[model samples]
Target: MADGGAPTEGRGSVAAAERGATAIADRVVAKIAARAAREALDGVPEGGAPPRATVTVHHDVARVRVSLELDYPSDIGGQCGAVRHRVAERVEALAGMDVPEVAVQVERLHSVHSRRAAQGRIR
Candidate 1:
């Protein structure tokens, strides 16, 4: 060992292949995907739950599924697209894994009209 405790070169140092690899857990990747989706959406809608994600990683490839609720009267397709793009980009950048697919599921839509109706504010 060197003064700094690091392995000294040519002093019985093992090859890179001998060292094991670092693996990022599936839950960590899922959290990353969820956060990325939130970032893409700017935040969760009022009376709506934040995005939740599930990820499967295999051989450095990640497949993700994100479920979220959004405000009604908005661009649903565009929002989903943004989430997919951001998730894929972030997971690849942070986890160093290939994101082959991101499936976005819109769990619910919060609408002002529905709330008003439920509150007896509308005819």
Candidate 2:
């Protein structure tokens, strides 16, 4: 005679224990991508908060589009590359998702001289 009980170890036991799967939200992915983009700023001043990012996830694949305001005269290509790589890595590591593409848009550019001029006006 044998008792009907769940097995302690085995593929069947693992599968049986996982009664349901976990689902990740789009907003959660967007936030993580945005933070990853910020980490690519390198030496630039990130002001106060991370830049905005729009992310669309489908069937476990995430497509991210990030908007950034980078410093003027910097290595634009290098920065964008960094953002793309960082966002993909973050999404995979943190969200456990696959990011096939990361589109980066430089919406604005802030110049050091311009910032100094604006600050000088305040005083």
Candidate 3:
């Protein structure tokens, strides 16, 4: 009876350890994702607007989804592509994790004029 109980206890410990590891991984991933977003936005003008971005991590280890609303140049298609590539590369490099997919959703386009007004400034 003692030997059988020892095995059960070991298994329970292993399960708890696995859960802890997963929680740590999730936190690491979130930090990586936030860093990636900031890096991708580097060199881009914020127009004095707050960040409008959201990142979601899927249950699958190698997948991340980002939604962003930001200001970009008029010919923005290319810029959008660059943003995605930069974010993917940054997260993969910093996190040391394989990012099989990164889905980017552009939620809104911000205007400098509107942003200035919102800041109570007159052009």
Q: Best candidate per TM-score, number?
A: 1
What is the lDDT, from 0 to 100, of the residue 65 in candidate 3? Answer: 64
Flag regions of model 3 displaced more than 4 Å: 1-24, 43-60, 116-123
Model 1: per-residue Cα lDDT over 1-123, one tens digit each: 878787876899876778789999999999999999999995788778999999999999999999999888889999999999999999999999999899999999999678778889645
Candidate 2, 1-123: lDDT as tens digits: 125665556534565546777789999999999889988786445453357899999988999999888887789899999999999999999989999999999888878788788889995
On lDDT, the stronger of 1 and 2 is 1
* Every model's TM-score: 0.84, 0.79, 0.55
The alpha-carbon RMSD values of the candidates against the true structure, listed in the order shown, are 3.0, 4.4, 7.7
Considering only N, C-alpha and C atoms within 3 Å, which residue pairs clash in candidate 1?
A: none
Better of 2 and 3 by TM-score: 2
The TM-score measured for candidate 3 stands at 0.55
lDDT of 3 by residue, 10-112 (tens): 5435555565643336556655665566566644456433223334455544576666666744546665576667767876676655677767666678787
